[model samples]
Target: MDGIIVRRVIPSDNSCLFNAVGYVMDHDKNKAPELRQVIAATVASDPVKYSEAFLGKPNEEYFSWIQDSEKWGVVLTWLLLFYSEGAIELSILADYYGREIAAYDIQTTRCDLYGQEKKYSERVMLIYDGLHYDALAMSPFEGAPEEFDQTIFAVRKDRTIGPAEGLAHNFVKEQQRKRSYTDTANFTLRCGVCQIGVIGQKEAVEHAQATGHANFQEYR
Candidate 1:
């Protein structure tokens, strides 16, 4: 076996923070602090405020254990910063077999988290980019075993760049496509960046080969 295993991060989602921060630390492992600062500067986010969202809500005991698990601490930290000030619309999870489940936990929790306040603005909408979470939560398959399905949360809904089922030859495509679409109130296509949408197939083939970064498998 390749030694990869997947599990649902629920029944108390303490692991989400760990996995998120670990990804940041590991992925940025080689970057020096100054270089990271340059990158962080481009992020346009406030780490301190975002960190607060990481502690959004967990029972004291479970929260402590999650913070203490060394394996995922860094990942969790990054995730907190990534989603800190940003409102969470929803989240999705998918496993090797491709069973997809989406949820509006971010929105629902925001309501419970913020709306309960006496003077909070009802104008604060959970604001879903799409209804994939609505569809998944409204789905009736939670009892299924090992079904860690949440691809939509991680995929783009655009006709260009990515649409999960669309062509994307790398993680850059996956992550960047998301940043392009879901991180804001709207998404737009960059003809220079994602010309694959309008260009002819053969032309796109030539364009993709121009970078030597794409393959047919990107569609699958």
Candidate 2:
């Protein structure tokens, strides 16, 4: 309760979610491939649970798509170019690791718990700023090294969530004040494959669908 909780930034190599989750789960940021395999295995082991209706695509497609390190996106109502994970992945991970994953959204300042109803003994925190995921950890003192930070907390530790939520609120507020998140609805993007300019998320989706180009880069 007396520790300083800080946001641990993760790389934006299109695997930030997995890396952040890995950091919070194991203090290892390079566990993306293993974690992806875990998700694939979990899904494969439960075809009925991770069916087309739940996965938004055929089970086989999602299995390969998630395993492919070069591929991304979760196929929500709309698609972003570099999305690595979503609620579905979070749920799978929660079950796989037997820990609740609390994701605090910077845009909405809402904490979404992946394994809320489950009986998990531990919980890990992640920060979501619309497009990227970062980890939250508690350090023993100010400016302490990351090696001393604690990323996982006991589920019954009522003190942990309070500080985590406070820090998340302040951090998200500051980020919002600076307009730090990409406005997917209105952000300008250029197709990396064909070098065609696209406006907004809808236009980007249309361009990708029409031209079969999945690569896109944001441009102001």
Candidate 3:
């Protein structure tokens, strides 16, 4: 996809997107109001985008980023209205770029570029307050994937063991430990649902075959 920057305008920014948004605002003093209306209408048409951008995310994928663009547009337009009040006039964000950069007064004032390991680009913010603090930059991926659990299938893939022999220990002791003693794929299943790569399918079939014979007994 083509690379594009999304940001608010601020003092001394020299970036293309910053200047473009700032120029638009300067030409039409009421452009902020119009931008807001456009944003509201656009957002109304696509609520998913608004929600994804404002909130952390619906998921860790590009679709979420694209959906959030609508809300980003709304914030950008709203920020332009603050030019008179010295509020952050713009925030520059590039969805395609591995890194993100922002500017003040048409100049690249602040830039955040990570090492090659970064999966996605960062967000650039604008601050118009006279206090001279840095424009707030927040990473969406931060504090994500807090909960990582393995399923029953995952265990079998990790360790070369079948459910029957492997389950002997558990059946004898009937102990349940819900912690990752090994890697994500190797950990023992805490329960039936959590069994995975470690447990072979043959064991299950053999057990069923041995136990089969219609053992159903109805109580009167």
Candidate 4:
């Protein structure tokens, strides 16, 4: 591995994926909207190729939804990787969901709409934590760059530091405590059918059963 440094992008309004991609491409965060449009257009043009199984919605509807500044998921991940490969002519290695870093190679069996094959010769890396994204850049270190298996490094189980583990544990505990407190607090459920506010789960359930209003949203 070379002295590859991971850079964090500033948190945006749930636009981490866009920010991360922009940072890696040496572009401003504003590029996210354009990138989203590109991806939407690509999917829209060839709905059969990038079908509902990957897009998670009807093609046009999903395209409109993804254009908004929101958190992206696996669908956008693959779309962005494919788009970047074509745009920049680089194979991208994405560290996804803190589980695995997979490489998307454009120089592979990627067939285009016209059934044309294209190939790229460069590679880059991006990091994802199932919530946010970041970029990784490699530069000259003090010593020589050591060759290592990227697959092993990507899913290494022993990579978590002790302090990181402790902090993660504490964070989970805190979240649990907060959830418990919230659960105990008074909650109002608004029925989707009748639009009536019912207090408490028991009352809400009873109301739903009585009125056949199965849909509800919780309010504090």
Please give the lDDT score at residue 21 for candidate 1: 21
Rank candidates, TM-score, best first.
Answer: 2, 4, 3, 1
Superposed model 4: Cα runs more than 4 Å off: 1-4, 71-119, 139-220
Question: How far out, in Å, is residue 122 in model 3?
Answer: 21
Count of backbone collisions within predicted model 4: 1
Which digits, one per residue and each the tens of the lDDT, describe model 2 over residues 22-77? 99999999888998999999898899998887776689988998887765532331
Off by over 4 Å in 3: 1-22, 52-102, 105-108, 111-127, 130-220
lDDT of 1 by residue, 1-220 (tens): 1111122232112233223222222321122233223323322243443243344433332234332433122222222233532223111111211222222232222221222222211111111222111111111243443333322223223312123222112322343345422322222222334534323234433444465323221120
Q: Which ten residues in a row have the lowest lDDT in candidate 3?
A: 146-155
Better of 1 and 2 by lDDT: 2
Candidate 3 accuracy as TM-score: 0.22
Supply the TM-score for candidate 1. Answer: 0.20
Candidate 4 lDDT tens digits, 51-156? 7765445778767866776535322332333243223211111211122222212222121211012222222344433224444333344332322212122212
Once all C-alphas are superposed, what RMSD does model 1 give against the true structure?
21.3
Clashes of each: 13, 0, 37, 1
What are the per-model C-alpha RMSD values against the true structure? Answer: 21.3, 3.1, 25.4, 13.1
Highest lDDT, which number?
Answer: 2
Candidate 1 lDDT trough over 10 residues, lowest sum = 130-139
lDDT of 3: 0.26
